[model samples]
Target: MNTTTEDTDDRARRSIGARRNPASQEAILDAAEAVLEESGIGGFSIEAVARRARAGKPTIYRWWPNRTLLMLDVYRRFKNARGFPDTGSVRGDLIALLQNHLLGFWKDSLCGTVYRAIIVEAQNDPDAAKALYAYQEERKKATEVIIERAKARGEVAKDVDGRLIIDMVVSFAWHQLLINRLDEAMGSIEGVVDGVLMGCAGYKR
Candidate 1:
């Protein structure tokens, strides 16, 4: 009778553990981000993340095979938090977008650290570089759609290259975020819009 009760209790415990494992996976990812921020990518390891998450290394390896992929998960979490904004007008929209990006980079230490690590990893890892490129392309598509809407409304010039302008806008913002502090970065929506219009517009107001 004692042995049977012990087996039943063990089974119950395993069942509860199984139920909570998914949530644990999320916790592990969160902990991984913290570790990455505290130690940087150079120091990140599966064992370290497990220690931070308070789970075994097997639990982490079950979900993410490597630290790079795990960091990607952290990046995805940050990206999801800052949903894309659609402010109606191109000028307003561009400004809002840049402001949100700068704010995220400056305010969110985990995100800032992850972004820096990804930039470094992309230099050597082709897979990491491809993932970053894909993320950028998706963002470009969103901006391109807005630019098309503006062109249709006669708000922007028809001859302007949407892709080129998008590249310019992103390049400038990235430069500001990477080189200077967000506060010091010259990322005014009005300024970007004005500069773009000066080059692209046929008529001046």
Candidate 2:
């Protein structure tokens, strides 16, 4: 068969495998994550992922067109597996969310490594950048919901921009996470959340 025909056949087989066997998809993502953690972004390849996953190279290539897409899939899987936290109040919710995020980034070496790789890839790859943006947007929406709840409770100013506050909180936590360990950064999250809340509360709605 010609190259294009072979690629099409491989993709078809992969789709069938994924639909019939969800484990196969999970296995591929797990393997891709291992390759990323071990070799970083530049070293990722179908062969490395296949070897780690214990699947055929054709399977890896069939499921993911490239290493970046595979890594993206792995990230999605990891995020979903961890799930999200929800506390009653906005401050409590923010703290819980930030703490969970920090722990995930710091405790899991594989997660941290893959995240760094994704950041680097996003710097030069438009598709990766778009994916990162979408992820952030989703996070912002969640944060916004918390802020809106606070506003309804009269804990925060009605006119306050939740997106801006979310951005600031995320920026501070991200800097701390990147520069220091999560344990070292835990002390700052509460204060940061409180300060932002105070500022929003003071605003004349």
Candidate 3:
């Protein structure tokens, strides 16, 4: 077989395109965020992202098998951009998390819309439901770490399961998001945190 220089260059380009490039991936993510922000979830699609990113549809699909996975990645980026609370106490941390991160992030038009769409999408799509569940499992692990810290300080009861507390708080936030009441819930976040604390510590208050 005679291999020409042009043939070698063609193969090299194909190889590069077949593998993921960090810069290209970042560009695609950036484009996805922009598309969602400008068009909302209703307008978000793989084709739209590909057009905005100036990448091929195959590239996007190669990196993310479906819209659910791509959307989750976009949501994860929004979250990873922010810092998690570490207020030295579980109560303080929970309150800060609600006030500073969860509520604040959900209050954003882009983040809130993406999350709400994901939840609604999950109800009808098995793949979306799976992706959401898997994503939340990772979040639960993070919550476990916070609980462990509280346990070390004797702030939480020995028998209390941290997952339950986090689930409660997260459920509250999701309800607020669904009801379009994130702003309203912000005022009551401290009380909510305290209630969860009471459960964890068995306090009379």
lDDT of 2 by residue, 36-143 (tens): 777876788888887887677776777665676677778767766666566778889788767776444445556665666676788898877888888778867865
What is the C-alpha lDDT profile of model 1 across 109-186, one tens digit per residue?
556656767777778888778877887788788668767877888888898789887788777777665774656553
Location of the lowest summed lDDT over 10 successive residues in candidate 3: 11-20
Instruction: For residues 90-176, write the lDDT of model 3, one tens digit per residue.
Output: 988898788766887888547887888889888999888999999999987786777889999998778888899889889999999
> Residue 64 CA error for candidate 1 (Å)?
3.8
Sorting all predicted structures by lDDT, with the top scorer first, yields 3, 2, 1
Output the better candidate (1/3) by TM-score. 3
Show model 1 residue runs off by greater than 4 Å. 1-25, 37-43, 54-65, 102-104, 157-160, 186-189, 200-205
lDDT of 1: 0.70
> Model 1 clash pairs?
none
lDDT of 3 at 165: 88
Q: How do these models rank on TM-score, best leading?
A: 3, 2, 1
1 against 2, candidate with superior lDDT: 2
What is the lDDT, from 0 to 100, of the residue 90 in candidate 2?
Answer: 85
| lDDT at position 91, candidate 2 | 89
Span of 10 residues, lowest total lDDT, candidate 2:
12-21
How does candidate 2 fare on TM-score? 0.72
TM-score of 3: 0.85
